[model samples]
Target: MKGNTNKIIWLTGASSGIGEALAYELSHKGYKLIISARNEKQLILVKEKCKYPENVAVLPLDLAGFSTVGNGVKIAIAIYGRIDILINNAGISQRSLIMETGLEVYEKLIIVNYLGTVALTKEVLPHFISKKSGQFVTVTSLMGKFGSPYRSGYCAAKHALHGFFDVLRMEHDKDGIDVTLVCPGFVQTKVAINALIGDGSSQNRNDTATEQGMPAEIFARKMIRAIEQKKYEVYIGGKEIKGIYLKRFFPNLLHKIVLRSQYR
Candidate 1:
């Protein structure tokens, strides 16, 4: 995965944040990229910023729109004949309490963050199975490791990703398929501002924690190393990443801190 000139990598949510940073990082490594996002214009900007702009293509995709995911997959395949890796980075966050949130927001989160990712992977599964070589990379969050304030739905969706991908890795191991579940604690991205509120509207404001989180470029550099090493699971971020380990060795300690932690 390092300095591979012909490898094809398809990535969703490439319009901004970690995905955008990855476009540049992988481009520098000389990988052909099929970058997708709901915004074609922003995708184009990402492609232009790539080290090898000619090797990148903008594939507009809407994960929430199941009907369009398959088409996007086909177009991505058309770009490089086949994809060596698929990065599921397309997701939305939540920024409201469970009681204040509506059922519709939870449903949308499941649809886009969980089902949509699964659907895209399935569309590309046949290709990977036939070749018996490919990687599935998902960008989950630290919240996936433990429940947190103001993110019940987001946490549920990410936790579901862990369950689904663990099964995928186990079932496909014999087929030589690799899965990397990346749990990022937090990064300086617009995730907080774009998070859905109780009424299913965007939060429209960035939180202090997000403003001071790790830069997406640094996070992407570390991510590329983990991907190249073919890690099954890894966590990246600031001190918050420690929460994952704490949850494992000291459940009660983690539980107490998480409940009182004001993520916003």
Candidate 2:
């Protein structure tokens, strides 16, 4: 699907941050887009800002509420006849230690970050299988590759995404199904401010590293290139991208460095 301007892309979490930037970029490239988020109003605002506002459709979705996902998928397909790509970008972050976090917090994390994405994917899987061509671009985090402080549940959910999508690529390669796992280290966004804390409430604060990380627009550009190339996976960020290699070849050293780092 590289260089295909007619492709239809359904992007979640399009109301803000990286997703918003991606919507703008993709729409500018002449691709039809269906932007989704829990807030329909914000989704509309984002659509208006796109290069081709008339080509952008807003579909509000609640990832935590999986029961409505099937119908949502149906509506998404109807919007553009079929979706060429599904960008799984909707997920919540965590900013609490495991010891103090509530069970419900972890449950919400898994539901929104893992189960919700899986449910949506399952709903769309049959269509892909029928057509024998589709793409799933999941916006996981660098935490998916390794650990970090104040993000135990977030890390677990992201790591789960890697596992699930990896197997998906393996099982559906023959069907022409493509899975691209995008791991982002730190992007200047509201993710940290919206992160859940021990009491199941938003952290409501910005993170130092996140504020200083790469711009969401820049990350979006790189991410789209990777998607166009149909890469199996790609990591986007500043120096923090090195953590992936550090974890792979120097586990103990990475662990020590993580403990001493101030990013959390």
Candidate 3:
């Protein structure tokens, strides 16, 4: 399976961080890729850095622009004839208290992280159903399973993703569609620096935990292995991954631990 080069993947948020890392890894494995993000230049740069640049195509996509997703999907399909997998990795993080966060901020979070992903998935669903074999690998966050301070809107958006994708898997498994929800904890990326603040502006700073988290390359390797294995769900991170179990078995303890940590 690792040697199969015919598989084509459409990966969103391919310009940076985990998406960028995933692009490089997939290219190394000889998968044809159509990479997308709002930043065309960054996407091109990422594609150029891949091991097999010839196997990569760039498609600039803005998840917030839901109306354009149909056209985008058409363009993506034109590049590869069919998309074997759709990686929903483009999303924004937040670093604001709920009370201070504006309604607009929450709306943008929902649009980009939840609704936009849903829109893209819906656009691709028909094609996947027609093919009777396709994968939806969504990159959510550990926050999706539990809560944290200063990430109220972000958590809510990620939480919604879990709900939507879970149902998608249940509804489409008969069609041979697979859904893998990858919930990542902090990684050494610009996510913290680029996170949205209370007024919808970028946070413009890094969080301590994020700076000290696992490197993107390492995280991508583990994630790719999970994808190759076709796991239904995988949580990748440091000790933070344990939060999933904590949330399940000891909600109060998890709350106390999260409150004490006060991560931003």
Give the TM-score of each candidate.
Answer: 0.97, 0.98, 0.98
Residue 215 of candidate 3: its Cα lDDT?
96
lDDT of 1 at 202: 100
User: Which digits, one per residue and each the tens of the lDDT, describe model 3 over residues 140-201?
Assistant: 99999999999998899999999999999999999999999999998999999999999889
Residues 170-205, candidate 2: write the lDDT tens digits: 999999999999999899999999999999999999
TM-score of 3: 0.98
For model 1, residues 107-209, the per-residue Cα lDDT tens digits are 9999999999999999998889999999999999998888788999999999999999999999999989999999997899999999999999999999998
Error of 2 at 89 (Å): 0.2
Candidate 1 vs. true structure, TM-score? 0.97
Q: What is the lDDT, from 0 to 100, of the residue 11 in candidate 2?
A: 97
What does the lDDT read for residue 43 in candidate 1?
93
Pick the TM-score winner: 3
